[model samples]
Target: MQESVFCMVVSRTRLIQAIACFLSLYKTMDNFKVYILCVDEKCYEFLKKINFDKIVLVTISELNREDLLAIKASRKLNQYCWTLKPGFIKYILTLEESIKRVTYIDSDLFFYQNPNVIFENQPYDSVLLSSGEVFLPMYSKEVNNTIQSLTGNFNSGFISFKKDIDGLSCVNWWDKMCVDSCTSNPEDNKFGDQKYLDDMPFLFNNVYEITTQGVNIGHWNSSKYKFTVLNDTIMVNNNKLIFYHFSGFRIISKYDIRQVHEQDRVNTPFIYQIYRRALEKIINDVEKIDPDFKGYFTVDAVDDN
Candidate 1:
């Protein structure tokens, strides 16, 4: 089988979730390779010890971009992470001759099956993206509808591309936009790196969107899917779930995580807790590393002071 590389940006702020993301991916798939842009020194140091042969750890300082370093000071945490996506993906592909393709995925995603099942069947000559559940009638809330209307029916949580001319053209265009100005503002026709993808199919050649319903099930649209556990496997719409994006899952207290974005996520599915345990285990690991590790901002553990 052929091998491929994947990239994601991670930080000490979301260190535990990053751990769960890595462990889950390794457990679920054996085909794809991984490279992470460690957002800080501590995260990079911690990941180096895990030492899986398929894993390569990269750091922001190592990327040596003084410009991004400057931009970091002006952006909020979410804005900062989103802005780096395109430039970082392009940087990763250019860093190695053997790296011919790279897929960008979020660090909060947990896998239920081999992601290679998606990659192996990918239209290799094209740049690939997936649509969000925002289009579903079950997700007919005003907020979901508004965001979908602005962002153009796509989610940037998972995007893949080849290293050829067409892919590089997309990389250059996307990197320019993110680096120029990336923000949460949707009025300007850009909601960080994801919305910029809306223009991709029109501007670049061989762009493909994933239409398979079960691939990127996440908190935003997961409530629309019917999930059942048979023989210890979680099936959504009778298909094996590929991965679930735990986008807004946050630690509200020492031992509590809440789905802040989805108001009705209380009884969503048992699959939720399965990924939860993976994240909580990694949190426990971090606590052992330091009895006072304040690694909770986005996965924001409330200040127990």
Candidate 2:
């Protein structure tokens, strides 16, 4: 009886997330409940401005209290990848609690295209993420192989899963991989947790692959693809890209040209525009929430640099 109720509740939560994902696409609301796992207060505060009441805000502290007893073992190796442990641990705990089925988008990404389609369209029991084509080579060979051993697939930016023990197991698997003391190959440390996540899909049965354009598109190496932007509509090939991950690059002002140059620069006009608009939105929204919030970026500095 308990299992049946839990399944039903998860089904409902996915529906809510589906609807929220669509609404987020339309309005670009940072208010979605799924964003509760963020460890960055500035990002969270900016999100809090737009939809103060509706943002599904959860602090790192609230999510990782020692009392949870869920993943206390991971506490010690927190040194291995402390920046990621809080969010990853929280994701595992949340999935275990049956609070919701989870999808994690990195802080460096911004949604321009509706991700609802990505969530609704896939048939897997879980979604294994890989860094988009632009960024995968940034990892070393050893890390990549280790990841494949774990998931038989590679990705980290946008992972989707149904809330269940299997999901928690996968999350736990990732936590262990991040802190694994097994080998100290110097190359593995170069990519950090991302290289560790490459093998995630193999850990469980319901694994689905999210195609290249669906998530995490940007200038790690994204120049080969053609980009077309017609007003607010952006497309790659004939199909639109869902979101662009602004990894290792910074947008100076909302309308500024991207600061990072890659071989794929000329081809991604649509993605460039998405980065511009999203950056502007984040900066503007942050000030509305906290008048005192002084972010480092300004029009002149970003434009000049």
Candidate 3:
């Protein structure tokens, strides 16, 4: 059996969410390894104490690239985190010679089923990408085109790269591009590390786009799909929901969470309810580890109505 390897980058603010992501993955999959790149000392120290099985914690310094450090001060926290994606994936691919593929997962994602569904029939030498196209009927052609132009055709949240010539070339090029200038300046046609993914298919061979609707059901496209809970399993468009990206979902207080997308709250309340419970549990666990640790809790007011 081929080894299942995944990687993610997280900072202190996202520690709770990262742990929730790992726990979700653990519950859904039997055998897999996750490599978490800690973006801050606090996150690194906190996770080190947990010492999660099948999880490898790596510090930012361990990446050992002066280029990333040089521009760290100039980039925003999120931009810097975005910039680390490709380099981190490359580092894992090179560091683990025995592993054939490395999939990059965003810390904000929660797994609902075995992600092997995404990789099962994929070509060994291909780079797998999650489609970022919004499926809402509200989005006009012009708006969709603009979105594509700004954010690109793929979401950087879930990308799998095989340790072969084409895959290596794509990751290396992306790493170099990100190290050069990974700013969120849409005027420059650069929206951090995500927009660059638009060139992957054209620049490399065997770049496959994951067309499975359940693979990355998120706020951007969730409204277009029908979500139903059947026999205790979440189904999206008749397929078993694999994972959901909780992007922009913020915890305002212990009892208040701000679901940024109003449609998401309306269309997929069940998913959010499940995620909220998981987050509450993870937050309680985190508080036990550090009494004063408030992971990503904001003071903003949330509309309860």
Consecutive 10-residue window with the lowest summed lDDT within model 3: 296-305
Q: Which ten residues in a row are the worst by lDDT in model 1?
A: 296-305
The digit string of per-residue lDDT tens for model 3 on 160-242 reads 99898998999999999998878766658777888888888999998989966588767777777888899999898789899
Candidate 1 segments exceeding 4 Å error: 135-144, 298-305
Pairs clashing in candidate 2? Answer: 129-155, 130-154, 130-155, 147-199, 150-199, 151-199, 151-200, 151-201, 151-202, 223-264
Which digits, one per residue and each the tens of the lDDT, describe model 2 over residues 1-305? 01111010111112222223334444653334444443346544554555534335545555445433334344422122233442454454454444445666544555666565665566445544545443335568686565444432344546665555666677676656654432223263434456555455556666656654546655544554567766767676666767765544444433443455443444445555555554566556545656665544444433211
RMSD of 1: 3.1
Number of clashing residue pairs in every model?
Answer: 0, 10, 0
- Screening candidate 1 with a backbone cut-off below 3 angstroms (N, C-alpha, C), the clashing residue pairs are none
Query: Which residue pairs collide in model 3, if any?
Result: none
- Runs with alpha carbons beyond 4 Å of true place in candidate 2: 1-32, 38-53, 65-100, 134-153, 179-186, 230-232, 251-270, 281-285, 288-291, 297-305
Candidate 3: residue 229 lDDT (0-100): 90
**Over 4 Å off in model 3, which ranges?**
263-265, 297-305
**TM-score, structure 3 vs. true:** 0.93
Worst 10 residues of 2 by lDDT: 1-10
Task: Return the lDDT, model 3, position 152.
Answer: 76
Query: Candidate 1, overall lDDT?
Result: 0.76
